[model samples]
Target: MPASDPVTSRPPLPAAIIAGTVALIESAGPLEDQSELVRAHGAQATRSAQFMERAWLLGERLGLPDDLSRWRSTIHLVVAALAVLVALSALGMSRAVVGESRSINAIAALVTLLGLHFLTLGLWLLSVLWPGAMSGLSLGRLALWLGARMPGERSPHALTVVRATNRLLQERRLLPWAFGLISHTIWALAFVLILAVLAFGFSFHSYQLSWETTILSSEFFQRFVQIAGWLPSLIGFPVPDPVAVQHAGAQGLTALTGADVQRDWAWWLMGCVFTYGLLPRVGFALLSYLRWSAGVANMGQPDSGDPYVRGIFARLEALDPPLVTDEERRSTHPAHTLPPRGPGIPGTLAVIGFELPPELPWPLQSLPVGIEGTTVLELRLAGAAAERQNAIQALGQIRPWTLLLVCHGASSPDRGTARFLRETSHRVEKSRILLVEAEESNRLSNSASGLRRWSDWLKAEKLDAIELVAFPEVGQENA
Candidate 1:
C-alpha cells in the first residue's frame, strides 16, 4: 500500500498518544511556528483532523515518530526473548519428567507442567478482580518497562510519549487487558511446545507412568485419577479403570509394562494438558485481545476542549483571513448613539487593546479619579496569531465584572475585529468598546470619520448592546 493510505496509518491508540504528546510539548513551550500548517489546513478542517495533522507534522519534525518506532522495536525484542525463555523452560520441564530412571510420577509430572502456569493465572485473575492488587507486574508490563529503560539514543520526548500511552490506556481501563494478552499468549506458546515435546517422547521411548503416595491410601489415588481424567475421557482420551488405578498406586514404577497400560496413561496426561492448560490459555488470550482492541478503537481523539488544544484551534481560526463585504457609505446622521459613561467603572475589569498601533501607551496612564484602586487585567490582541491566541487564552481563565475593549479610532472596523469582540464579550458581566484617537495631527480627521463608521458597523453587526466610547488622548477623562 502507498504510505498515504489510511490502511497504513498508525493504529488509533498510537495516533492518539502521538497527538497527546504534541499537545503536551506545545503546552510546555512553543515549538516550531505552526502558522504555515494552519494556512495549509485552513479553518474548514475539523478540530480532530487538524490536531492529528499538526501532531503528525510536529512529531516528525521533533523525531517523535522515530522515537515511537524505536520503543515498539524494543518491546518486540523483549517479548521475543520472553517467548524463547518460556519455550526453553517448558523443554527442561519435559526432560525432567522423564529423568534418568525413565519413570514419570503421574502426580509430580502434572504439577511440574502446570503448577507455575496455574499460580500466575490465578494471580492475574486476582489483579483483574481487584485493580492494583498485583501492581501490574505482568509479562506485558515487564516488556514495556524494559523497552523504556533500554539503552539507546532516545529523544527527550520519548518518555513523554510512553507516559501519554500509559495514561491513555489506564484511563480507558485497557491496561490490564493489554498485559493479560501478552501473558496469556506466552503461556499458550509454552503449552504448545510442551505438547510437542511430550508427544515425541511418548512415541519413541518407553517410560513407566504411575501414581505413588507415601501418606495417602490407594483409594485416594484412585479417586484423584478418576476425577482428573473425567474431562479428558469425555473427549475420547482413555481413563484408567479402578483396577488399573489401584494397581498403579500399589505397583509404582513396576506396575504397568503392558502396551495398553502405557498407552492409556500417556494419552490421559496429554489430554489433561490440552483440555485444562492449552485450551484455557488460548481462550483467555482471545478474550483479552478482543477487549484490548475495543478499548483502542474507542480511545477516540484528544480533547478539543482542553486549554492547550483550544488555544491551538484559536490560533488556527485567527489565521484564516476574514471575508470582506462591501458596506454602504457612512451617513451624516449617527445610526446608533453612544451611551454615556455610567456612574462608575466596575471594581474588577478586564481591558483588551485590539489591533492598536505600537505608539499607543498600554494600561492608559489616565483614569477617572474615583476608580484608582480597581482591579484590572490589561492585555493586547495584536494581528499576530500567537498574540491573539495568548489574549484569548488569558481571557478564558477569568470572568471579570466588566470587559473594556480598546481599539484604534483611526482604523475602520472590519469583520475580523467585530468577530473577536462578539466572541469575547460574553466572558464578563458587561462589555464595552473604547476607541482611542491617535496623537498624530494627520490622523485626527480619519479618527473622527472612523468613529461614525464604527457606530454604523456595530449596529449592522447587531452589537449595539456593547457600549462604545471615544478617548481623545492617552490620559482621557472618560471611564
Candidate 2:
C-alpha cells in the first residue's frame, strides 16, 4: 500500500465522536490490553487502520455513536424551528408597516425589516475578521445550546462530542464559519419570505407610500433614495426620482395622490430590500457554506505520531511474530560486573543498571548532564536472584533522593523487571528509567515506538509516576 493509503479518512462528525471517545476512555485509566483481539480481527491491517478500528470498537461499546446521533437529530430540529421563526418574523414586519394604514413610513419600514438583520450580519463579519469579538449569544449558538439540552434527557457523550468538534474546527479557524453558515441561511430564508409577502401585498392591495421625518430636508431624502436605489435600478428595479421624493415628503402624513407615484415608491421599497438585504445574505451564506464544506473535507484523522497512539500501535505490533532468526548466538561478557567505587562518598543520586546487555559498558562512562550531584552508587543487577536482592538492599542503605535505573532499549519489559522496579522505587524518594539504545546492527527497538511501549507498560504496572527517559545511542554518545 502507498504511504497515504495506510489510514482511511472518515467523515468529520463520526471521526470526531470516535476520537473523542478514545480520549475519554484513555483519560479514565489504562485500557484493557487488546493485543489478542487485534491479532484476531485486524492482523493484516496497517497500524493506523488497526488503531481507528480499535477506537470505533470501543466507541460502540460505550454507546457514543448512538448518543451523537440523537444530539445531531436535535440540532437539525432546532435549526428548522429557527428558520420558521425568522420567516414569521419577516412576514410580521412586512405586514405591520403596510397592513392597516393607507400610507407607509418608508424609512421606518426599512429599519423594521433590515435593522436586526444588518446588526447581526455586521457582528458575524466582525467575528470572522477578529475571532471572539462577537462572543455574545447568537441564533446559531442558541440553537446548538438548546438542541443539546432539549427533546429528552441529555446523553452522557453529548458534551464530549461538542468539545471534540469545537476543538477540531477551532484548530482550522472554521468554528465561526460553521455557525455563520447557519445564521446566514436563516437570514436568507427570511428575506425570501419577506419578498414573497411584499409581492403578494402589492399585487392585491392598494396603498400609498411616503416618508415622514421632522428634521430632515427633502433634498436629503431625495439623495438617500437615489443612492440607495442605484444598485437595484441597475438590475431593472424602479427607483423614485427627485420629484417623487419631494412630493412624498411634502405630503407628510397624507397619501401621495397619483397612481404612478405610489407604484414607483412601492417597487423602489421592494428593490432596496432585495438589493441590500437579500442579495448580501445570499452571497455570504454561499461563502460560509463553501468554507464549512472545505474544512470538513480536509479534516484530519487522529495523529499516528502522538505518543498515546504510538503506544496502541506498539502493542499491536507486539502481537506479530519475528520474521528473522539468528542461527547462532554467544555471550562473551559476564552477566553482572559491578562498577568500581568512585572517589567521592555516596551522594543523593544512585545509578543502577538493571539487566543491561553484556556487551554494553558498565561503570557508565558518561551520564546525562541535567542530573545534579555526585553519583552515590553504581550497581549492576543481573543473573541470579541474589544479586538483584543485593542491589535492592544497597538502594535502601543509600536512600537517594533520585534513583536512575538504566535498561537496554531492545529488551521487552517482563514481570521480573516490573517487580524489581516496584521494589527499588519504594526505597528511593524518586525513580526514573533510562533506556539506552543498542548499536544499529543489534537494535530491536524503534526509538519512538520503544519509548511508548515502555510508557504503556509503566502505566499498566501502576508505575506511571516513574519518568521514562530515552538515552542517546551508544555510538552517538561516544561520537
Candidate 3:
C-alpha cells in the first residue's frame, strides 16, 4: 500500500483482514487448547469457536442472518446486513480485479490482495459487532469445509483443550522463566520455517521460484489476501518476499505478489503440514506473546494466569500423560526434579524456529544441522511421555552439558512444548533451571547462556534440569 493510500490511517488491517484474523483464531493453539476449557464449560467454548468459524462460512457462503431475515427486521441486523454488503462490495472489487484481470503483474496482484482483504475485513466487523446476526459460524462448518479429506472422529476434547489452554494463559506458564518455549513458540516460528522454505525456493536460493518460492508464490500470496485463503498463511507469517520496497512490494509483499505467481508442489507441501498444526502454534504464540509482553503485567499481579497459561496447560494434558492429579497424589511418591541451574552453566540454546520439519523422507541426521554444540541429542520421540522419559534419561547421569535444545515433534506438528514447562514448573522448584521454548529447527548455543535467555527468576529460584516436552499429534498417525 502507498503511504497516501486511503487505508493508511485505517488500523493495521482491512475488511477481509479482520475475517482472516478471526479465521486464523479458529484452530489457533492458545485458543484451540481452549478446547480443554470447552470440556470444563461443557461445549460452550468449543461451540463458540465453532460458531465463529461456521458463521464466517455462513457469511461467505450463505448470507446475512435471521432477525434481518424477519425484520429486514431488527435495526442492528438491518444495518449490519447493509454495512456488510457495502464493505463486501468494496472488498470484492479488488478480488474481482484479480479474478477478472488478464494481467497478472505486480500492480494487479496488489489490487487483488487489497480487494480480498477488504471483503474479509467487512465480514470480520459484522461478526464482531453484529455476532447475533451471524450465529451460524462454527467448527462444524470447518468440518464441512474439510469435506471428504476430513480426519477421523473429532476429539471430544476440543472444549477441554480450550479450558486447559486458558488455564495456562491465566497462569502465565511459558516465557521469561520457563524452558521449552518449543511448543508455544512453534505457532509463531512455524510460519518462519515455512517462509524459509519459500525463501529457499525463490528468494535466497540460487533459483527464484522452485523449492523456495512456494510460500510466497502466486497461490500463497493471493491466499494471503482472501479470507478463505489467508488463515494458514497469516498464521504462518510466511513472508511473501524478502524485500519490502524496491520490487518486494509493501515490505516483502511485492516479491510475493509479483508477476507470474504460481502454486507448485512445494507450496502445497508446506501448506498441509504448516496449516494443520504449525500455523496454529504460531497464532497461539502471538496471543501469548501479546499477553506476556503487555497484557500479563497489566493485571497488576504476578499470580494471575496470562492469557496463554490456560492454553499451555491444555496442551500438556493432551499428551494423555500419566498425570497424578492432586487427588491422586500421595505423600510417598517422590516428585521428579530438574537438574540444578546457575550463572556459569555452559549449555547454550537455540531455535530452528520455522514451520514443519523438512519434507518427509528427509533422514533425521541428513536434515538441516543448524548451529552446533558439544552435545547434540536429536530427540525423535513419538509422544510427550516418551519425550519426558527421554528428558529424564538424557539429563540423568549426563555430564556438564553446555546446551539443551530439542527437535520439533517427530510426527505431525500439533504437539506443543510450552505447555509442558508451565505444568512442571508449578510443582517443582528444585535445582533451579529456566526454560525457553521455540519452533523452527536451528539454534546453536553453548550450555552456559542457555539458562540466561531462559529466565532469572527460574535461575534464582534454583530449579532442577528442566524438561521441555511436547504433546502428541491428535490427527492421523499416517497423515
Candidate 4:
C-alpha cells in the first residue's frame, strides 16, 4: 500500500492553526521551544507541513480528549450564522431601497445599488494605502466584533481564536489578505441576498418602472439605455426599445405603461443586479480567499531582515548542539566570607548568577571554598535569550572548570530557570552545580518545600551529578 500524503492527512486550516496555538500554550519548555520547532521543521518543509506537525504534536501531548478541535467546528458554525445574518440585513436594506411607491424610480435604485458598492470598494482601497487612519472602516474589526457576540456553543472560544490569530498574523504583517478574504465573503453574501429580495419584489408587486430626470432628455436617456444595457442585452436580458425609452422619459409613467414594456424593464433591472452587483462581489470574494490560502501555505517564509524572522532563525540556531558567542570576565569581591570549606569544590571554579537578588553582595561570599581568582558572571533569569545564550557560551569556553549556578532561594523555581539550565547543560561538559542562597535566618533542609521543589525539577532533568547547596543565614553571618 502507498503511504498517505502529509498534506492530505493533516486537518483543515482552522484546525491546524488552533492546534498549533494550543501547542504553544501547553509546551513543556518556554513558549520559544514551540517556535523553535516551527523554525526547525519549517526550514526543511512547507509551512503547511510545519503546521500539521504542530497539530500532531498537540494531539500527542494532550491525547484524545483535547478541545482544540472544537475551535474549528465552532468557527464553521459562526461563519454560517454570520452569512445568514448578513443576508437578513441586506434583505431589509433592499426593501428600503425599493420602497412603497406607486412608481419605482429605476434610475435611483440602479444608481444607489451599484454606487454604494463602488464607493465602499474605493474607500477600502484607500484605507489600504493609509492604514490606521481609516481603521474604523476595517472589516476585520467588524468581523471580530460580530464573532465575539455570536450566540452558540463554543462560539466564544472560536471567536477569541480568530481574534488572536488575526492579531498575531497582523504583527507579522500578514493579515491584509486574510482580512480581505473575510470582507469580500460578507459582501458577496449580502449582495446575493439583496438581489434575491429585489427579484422577489419585482415578481410579486405590480409597479411602473420609469426614469425621471429634469436635467436630462429623451435623446440622452436613449443613448444611456443603449450603453448600459449592452452587456445585459448580450446575455438575453430584455432591453427597452428607443420608443419605449422615449415614452418612459417623456411621460414619466403619467400614461399607462404596457405590460410587455414593464416586463422588459424588470428583466433589465434584475440583469443589472446580477451582472454589475452580484457577479463582481462573487469574483472578488473568490480572489481574496485564494490569496489568504496562499499566505497560509507560505507563512514560514517571511521577508528577509525582519526582526521577528531573524529571531526565529536565532531560535533554530540555538537548537543545534554547538553555538558560538562573545566572552566576558568580571568579578567583585566586595566582602569575603569566613571560609566554610566544603568537599565539592572542583580544581577550577566559575560562579554564575541567575536573577540573583540586588541585596546579595557582589562576589557572593557564601561559597564553602575560597574563590581568590575564580571568574564570576551574573545573569538575570528574566534576561533576553541572547544574554542567556552569551552567558552559556562564555561558560562553555572556560570549561574543564566546574560551574556553579547561584540563585535566590526565596524565589520559586520556574520553567524559565529550568530551560536555562537545560540549554546550558547542552553547551558544556563540566560539573553543573546549583547553589540556592537565602538569609541564614531561613531554614535549610531537604524537607523545606522550596528546596524540595528544586530537587524534584533537577531529578526530572537528570542533572543530579552536581550538588544542591542552600546557604542559610550566611548573609546575616557575613554582616
Candidate 5:
C-alpha cells in the first residue's frame, strides 16, 4: 500500500517533532510522565460505570494502576481456581483427624506459589527487580550477571546498574503472560508427576479397612477412600472414593479385588495425570469462558455464545461420552487455541509481525505506508531465544530512512520501553524512528515516553545533533 507524500520526507526534523509533542498528550488522554513509577495500568479503567468515582477512589487507595481492563479475566482465573480448590477440599472430606489441615496446607502451598508469581509480575513492573530479569527467567542467574556487568547505555540505571540486569531475548513486556503460562503449566505437570510417582511407589494398595468404619462411620474400604480423595481433583468425578470401582485384581476386603495391580495402577496413572494435568489448563479455559460471559453481560448483550467457548465445552463433554485411551490422552496439542483477535485502535495504523487474521481493517493491516524514502517492514519475532535475536539483528540490518516499531496495538506505558526505539533509532541513524504507541499498546511503549529518553540518550551519546521528528495523528496529517 503506497501513498503520496506531502513533503520531502527523508527523516522528520526536530522542530516538527517538538511541535507535535502535544498530540501525544492528546491521544493518550493524560500524561502523568511518571518514569519513576511506571506501572501497567490494568482493569482499573474498566470498572463498572455505576461505580466510577468509588472505583477510582478504591484504585487510588490500593495504589493499583489505572487501567483495570484486565481485572475481569485475571479475577476470573483466580476465582475459578479458588472454586475448584474449594470444591475439591469439600469433597475430599477427610475422616482422619489431621486430614483437613494437611489438605488445606497443600492447597495453601499451591496458592502461595501462584501468589508469588503474581508478586513477581508486580515487582518487575514496579522496577524493584533488576532490569529485564523476571520475564527472561529462562536466562537463569548467569544472564543476570551478564546484564549487570554490561554497562548501562542511556537507560536510567547507573552504568553500574548493568552489573545486575540480564540480557533477555525480548523485553520484559513480552515475558509476563507467556512465561506465566509456562511456569504455571510446568508446576501443574510437576504436581501430576509427583502424584504418579507416589501412587505407583506404593506396593500393597489392596489394603482395605478390612470391613471397618471410620470416626465418621464412613465404611470406606481403602480403595473407596483413596479414589474419593483423588477423583474430584483428578477428573471431577462426583463419587467420593475409588473403593467401589472394579476392573480386575486381588480379592477380599484387605486384599486386591478383580482389578489387576498393574492394570488398576495404569488407570490410576492416567486418572492422576488427567486430573492434575488437565485441570489448570481447563480451569484457564473456564476462566476465559467466565470472562467472556461477564464481558457480554456487562456490554449490553451477545447474540449467542462464542463458538470457541462452546467448542472447548464440547471437548470437555466428549471426555465422558467416548473413552479416550491413554495414548490419545498423553498426546500434546490436545486442544486448539481460539482464533486471533486484536485490541481496538482507531484512526491509527497497526501491523502485527505475524499474519494477524485478514479480518482486520485497512490501515491496520498495512501500516507505515506514507514514509517517503523508507520501506516499512513487519517482523514476527516469535519462537525460540535465537529467533528473537535474529529478528533484532535483521532489524539492525534494514538501514532504513525511518523505522517504526509497534506491537500488540496496546498503546500502554511500560518499563524501559524506550530502549527499543532508542536502539532502533541509533541503528537507523540515517533514518528517523517512530515508536507506535496506539491505544492497545499505548501504555509505556508510548513514543512520547521514549522521546525525552531518546533525546537524553542522544545527548549522552554525543549525538544530540541528529534531527528527530514525531508524527502525531495531526502531525501525520499535516506532513
Candidate 6:
C-alpha cells in the first residue's frame, strides 16, 4: 500500500486526529516508544490544533484508524449507563428511607442526593480563582480509561490502550479540561435522571412531604417553607399556606393527615429539585463543555513563544529551506566589515576548525597555496566535552558571514559534528560542512565514505549543502 502524505503537507481534521490518537494508543508498540513519537511530532506545532492534526496524521500512518465514531458512541453509552446506575441507586436509597414515612423531610433529601453537586461547583469555582488547587482531577484520563475498557473485542487491548491514551493526553495537555467536561456532564445526567425518578414516583404514589422539627416552632418552619418555595411558586407549583405549614409541622401522628396539601408539598419538592439541583448541574456541565471546546480549539495553534513550536519551526525550515533576506536595518553602532583580501590572501570567509587533524599545520597561518583570501577566524575542537563547550562559546562570538567548518575528511561524521553544525547554523548567514583533504594516503578511510557520512548527518540535521577542501603541499606553512 502507498504511504500517506506527510503530516506537514496539509491540514488535518480534528475528528480524524482525535480518532487517530486513540488508534495510536491501540497500535502494537511499547507505550514509551509510542509516546516518544508523539513528543517529537507534537513539539512541531505552535498551536494545539496544528499539533493535533499533525499528530493525527502521524498516528494514522502508524496504524491508528481514521474513524473513531464507534469508540465515541460506546463511551457515551457507557457514561450514560453509569449515570443511570447512580441515579437508580440514589432513588432506591431515597425510597428505602423516605417512601414509607407519611411525610418526607425535604431538607434531608436535597442534601443527601444533590449536596455533593453543589460542593463540586464550589470547588470548580475555586479552581478558577486559584489555579492548580484542583489540578489532580484528570477527567481526560478517566474518559480515556473508560474508552479503553469499553466492552467488546477491543477490551483485550484495554491496558495498552489506556497507557497510550494517557501519554497522548499528557502530550497535548488536555487532561483537566477533558476531566471537567466528562465528569460534570455525568453528574448532570445523573441529577436529571434522579429528578425524573422522583417525578415518576410522585405521579404514581401519594406521599405526604413536609418539614417537622420538635425543637423548632411551627412559625419558624412555616416561614422557611414559604421562603424556600417562593421560586417554585412562580412557575405554578403550589406553595402551602401558613395554616398548612403549621399542620404539617405539628410533630405527631395526630398532626399528619392525608390531605390535598400533600399535592402542594410534592410539587414544591420537584420545583426545588429543578431550581436547586438539576439547573445548577446542567449549568456547570454546559460551562465545562464550553471550556473543553475552547481547549480543543486552542490545540490547533499555540502561542508563538512556546519553545516546542519554535523548535519545530526550526526543523521545518531545514526541510523546506526558506528564502533568507538580509533586510535593511538601522543600528546606532557601525556594522562590522570583513577585512579586505589581496591576491595572496584568501577571500574574506571565516574558517572554523572542527577537530583539526594534528598533522595538518595549526590555524593554516596562511590560507593553503591554492585557497587564498580566506581568514582563519578560529580553531575549535569538536569531540571532547570541555572542548565542545569552548568551541560553542568561541563560535557564538564570531561574525555572521560565510563559515567554512573544517572537518577531518578521513573520520566519519558523528553526533558531535552534527551538534556543532546545528548550533552554529543559527548564528551565521551561511554554513558549509568542509571535509579536509588528507595529507597522506594513510588516511583512516576514503573521502567517499567520509562524504557519505557527512551527507547522512547533514540530512538528519536538515542541513542543505556540504563542501570539500584539499590540503596544500607538504611545506606550505604560514609565513
TM-score of each: 0.62, 0.62, 0.19, 0.53, 0.25, 0.50
lDDT of 1 by residue, 80-177 (tens): 88889988998899788765666788878988998999998998887678767776566556667789889988877888888777777766778788
Q: What lDDT is obtained when candidate 6 is compared to the true structure? A: 0.56
Per-residue C-alpha lDDT of model 3 across residues 1-479, encoded as one tens digit per residue: 01221122222212122223333344453232222332222221232232333223322221222111222123234334444554455344433433333323443433333344345335433543454443355222222233312333332332232333233332443222111122245223433543454335433322122222423664454443333335546655333332322233223332455343334222433453355445544554465456455533332121215333344334433432245657656456444333332332245322222232443221223212232344333343344565655544454334223323343333222334433333223222222221212342222222344434344323322222453332222242236
Report residue 477 deviation for candidate 5 (angstroms). 54
Candidate 5, residues 1-479: lDDT per residue as tens digits?
Answer: 11222112212121111112222222445222221111111111211111122222223322222112232234345445644663344223221212322111222222332343345435433432344454344422333343333432232322212221111112222233333343344445444444444344333332221222225333333454365346644444332234433312113232543435433443443354355444654454444345434432332111126443243234333322233578656645334211122221222221214222233222433333343432444554333445544554555444444444433322232323333333333344343433434443322233554666665654654345444444345455578
Candidates by lDDT, descending order: 2, 1, 4, 6, 5, 3
Model 2 weakest lDDT span, ten residues long: 335-344
TM-score of 5: 0.25
lDDT accuracy of residue 331 in candidate 4: 34
280-313, model 6: which lDDT tens digit per residue?
A: 7677667777866665554434335755445444
Clashes of 3: 121
Task: In candidate 2, list every pair of residues with a backbone clash.
Answer: none
**Per-residue alpha-carbon lDDT of candidate 4 for residues 364-462, written as tens digits (9 for 90 to 100):** 545644333455444444457777767766655554245667766667767677667655553334544444444542234324776777777666544
Against the correct fold, how does model 3 do in TM-score? 0.19
- The local lDDT score (0 to 100) that residue 57 gets in candidate 1 is 61
What lDDT tens digits, residue by residue, belong to model 2 across residues 327-346? Answer: 35434423322222222233
Which parts of model 5 have CA positions greater than 4 angstroms off? 1-154, 157-180, 195-214, 219-254, 257-273, 282-479
Q: Which regions of candidate 2 deviate over 4 angstroms?
A: 1-10, 28-30, 33-48, 151-155, 252-256, 304-479
**Clash totals for all candidate models:** 0, 0, 121, 3, 47, 18
